[model samples]
Target: MVRVDRGLATTIGGAGVARVGYSGRILEAAADDPASGPCVGDWALVARWTDDRSTLEHLLPRRSCVTRAQSGGTSHAQALAANVTLAAVVVGLDQTPAITKIERLVALAWESGAQPLVLLTKADLAADAAEIAADVLTSAPGAEVMCCSCVDATGLSEVRDRLGDGTMALLGSSGAGKSSLVNALVGADVLATKEIRADGRGRHTSVRRELVVLPGGGCMIDTPGLRGVGLSGGEGIAATFADVDALAAQCRFNDCSHESEPGCAVLAAVEEGTLAVRRLESWRKLQREAAWVARRTDARLRAAELRVWKQRTKGSRGHPKRR
Candidate 1:
């Protein structure tokens, strides 16, 4: 099976296009367009073209995909990257990291079938970097947490060492220093970086997602900073809040809501101070979002099916009887 390193989408005369990187050369290819356009880190099969124009035959199966609910009122999910092995949830140390946002992103990463790594960037700016890292570790239960400063290159080696010969993706909000971290890992000024504003928000320097080869023998996809991350249906919620799920398993009722219910082990844990109330609330909020997305997706699927059925039966209903 022939495969390329990076499948980054670029624009051609206002038309969305995809490029395949192979043997240190970039090739423009035609891709079988889907409802959602090709994303970074996608694996695709390319057809050899005699003419200058190349065609993307089809997209190969994705091992994993990082997706989020489309921002606007649309009930659609957007794919950030495809076939990612590691998802680095970058958070800036200059500001107090939002644990809830981290949890949400971790859930999305888990749902993508990739290993989630909580990365604390700009560690040099924060006086209590270690303390903040510890708090983030609590929010991310089963994932590895690391702190690094791009300015001094502290902990960059460790982060590079962890990404061993697989596609990794950088995910974070604006001003989380994702671009800086990418530049540090690649050891060059390949991506642009911007200064954080007085409001502590970083400018959106990366407008599109693109893949770059790491110096140490791996590829990484850098995505634009996310302002609002909504959840789609997946096992990420259960994985992010594994502690709460474990407690829920011990509940007397299999369908226990964990709210004012009899023999509710989850509530009991919260009452006994084992599980943090804030964590429980976050889990509940994500669960609700996931459920809503699932309903909307199902409705959309049903509507599509109905349209297909109507198209198939359209002219037949009005036809005259045949002998």
Candidate 2:
């Protein structure tokens, strides 16, 4: 699936790109759980009823998926891109880069089961781009980091080579130059571009998530600027904060909370200046959010099960068996 709207989807396959809708069963499933339906980058089987009509029949299992917790206090995971091999997290250096935001996106990418690549944009504008890149590297462990500029066309080739004919997804906030990066990669104005305001914030240019085919038949999904990136439950936290986890392993207690605990290795590192207090705090914040999300998800599952049990009991009481 390349695009998904209300009840319709567009698919790109060997047959070609065509718009399609969901089958009745699939629609029903989606109504209950949105993630059950088709998403962009999903390989699916489509059936054609007429020259102008088609329906998505079955969705193949996704090898990897990039998802985030749904906004507005929902306990559901919103799939950003499916079957993605690489997630390129774009950050602009025109202004002060938000390290916390970078950590969040890197965690999201790692949670997707895809390799995360951090691209610091606007390198030409920042003289200390390399220094900033080094700082970001500390936050994003196990992920490749690069500094690129679209103006002088620096590091674009390296980015392409890093992608290497695999499906990649662009993740960033507004004005991060994600669309501009896409245009440079495709060598044309394939996607729209806008100028940033005096305050250095970007306008919302790309309104939706769409997949653009790269030069060598590789796929890239360009996502709109994410304002509220709530994390879905996964081991991404551990992966992103591996440094913290490693210290926790050596704590006096196996379940050390790292908050004033006696003989806590994490606290020791913080006091010794080996670890940035900011990064440790970020880890604690994300861990709390993940725990809250897990509790909500478990509650939802239990409620669903109770509903089914009640329905079965009501049905059994409605009709007495005659022997």
Candidate 3:
């Protein structure tokens, strides 16, 4: 599936892109777990009844998926994309990069099981593009960092080279130049783009997550700017902060929280000027969030189990079996 909207999915196959809806069984499965539903970049089995109508019969196992804690404070995870090989965290250099947000997004990309790439867009606008990129590299450990300017075409070839014959998904906040990056990669004005305001705020140009096959092979998904994305787990966080994790391994206590704990290697690094205080704080913040989400999900699962038990008990009592 290249794109999913409402109850329909647009899939690309040998027959070309076709609009499809879910079969009854698939709809029930989706109702029970929205994450199981087809998402952009997913592969599916489709049954075509006619040229105008088709049904999504089954979803193939996804090799990778990008998910986030759904917005509006729900513990449910919203699947962003599936089967993505490369996840690019796009951030514009027009304004001061939100290092904290970058850390969060890097975690999201890491959790997706795809290699993360931090693409700094609008690099031409920032004279200290390299310096800013260096700082971002520290925030996003285990991820490649690149500074590109679609305007002057600087670094476009490098970007294309990095995306050789694999699906890459662009993840970023609004006005982060996701659409522009897609146009540059596609080598044409295939997607609509809007200019960022003087204040650096960007309007939504790509309203939906859509996939396009690149000219040189491979595919790319252009997504709307994500203002804020919640982390669903800490696996990505640990990967993003591997340096901090390495320090934590040397801590005196096995369960050192790294707060005010004595002999905490993480804090010691901060004092020794090895680790940035901001980066540590960012790790702590995301850790708390991931823990909270885990607790909420566990509770929800327990409640569901209890409901099933109650229903079974009621049925047994209401319908007595005869010997």
Candidate 4:
């Protein structure tokens, strides 16, 4: 499925006329049909007959999925794209990149089972671009950090080289120059560009998540700017904060929260100037968010189970037993 808007699916290829599937049309086919609903970048099996236009027959198992907790007070998650191999977390150098935001996106990318790359865009706008990138590197840990200016075409080659022969997805807040980067990499104006607001935030130019084939033999998915990204379940936090994990290992207490606890290696590191207090605070905040999301997901699952049980036993108490 190339795009899914509302309940209508925009399908390309296969056979027959491209048919549009209405809301609940695909799910009505089978009880488990909803489980296989298409997301952006999903390789799905579709019925090509003229009568079955827009209906997805099945969604192939995803090797990886880029997901985050659904916004708005919901415990459910929203999958941004599926089967992405490279997740480029873009940040704008025009302003100081938020370490906490980068950490959260990197964790989400890691949790999605994709390799995360940190891209600092608008290199031409920042005099201290290198220093800002170096600071972000501490948050990204194992990920490679690259600075690129779409205007001057600096570091674009490195970005393309790193994306070699894999599906790469550009993710960042609005106004981070993700679309500009996509246009640069594609060598054409495939996506639109807009000016950053006076407040230094980006306008939401790309409203939908769509995939585009790159000139370099790889495909990419450009997503709209995200304001809030919540964590689902994954080891991304630990992976992003591996240094803290290592420090925690040496703490005298196994249950060290790294806050004012005695013999806390993490705190000790902060005191000794080995670790940045801001970094530790960001890690702790993300951990708490992840934990809260996990609890919410578990509660949702249990509630679903209880509902199923209630439905199954609705009239059993008054029914006669069959011999």
TM-score of each: 0.87, 0.95, 0.95, 0.90
Candidate 2 weakest ten by summed lDDT:
314-323
Model 4 CA lDDT for position 117: 88
Report each candidate's C-alpha RMSD, comma-separated, in the order given.
6.0, 2.6, 2.6, 3.4
Instruction: Show where candidate 1 strays beyond 4 Å.
Output: 1-36, 315-323
Question: Which consecutive 10 residues in model 4 have the weakest lDDT in total?
Answer: 28-37
Candidate 4 residue lDDT tens string, 121-217: 9999998888888888888899878999999999989888888888888889989998899899999999998998898777788999877778748
Tens-place lDDT digits, model 1, residues 224-274: 898888888659999888889999999999999999999999999999999
Which residue pairs clash within candidate 1? 30-56
Q: Model-by-model lDDT, in order?
A: 0.79, 0.88, 0.89, 0.82
Model 3, span 137-173: residue lDDT tens:
9878789999999999888889899999999899998
The lDDT of model 2 is: 0.88
Query: Cα lDDT for residue 160, model 4?
Result: 84
lDDT of 2 by residue, 11-74 (tens): 8878888998899888887767777678888999999885678999998999998888887766
lDDT of model 2, residue 155: 87
TM-score between model 1 and native? 0.87
Please report the candidate that would top lDDT against the real structure: 3
Candidate 1: Cα lDDT at 68 = 86
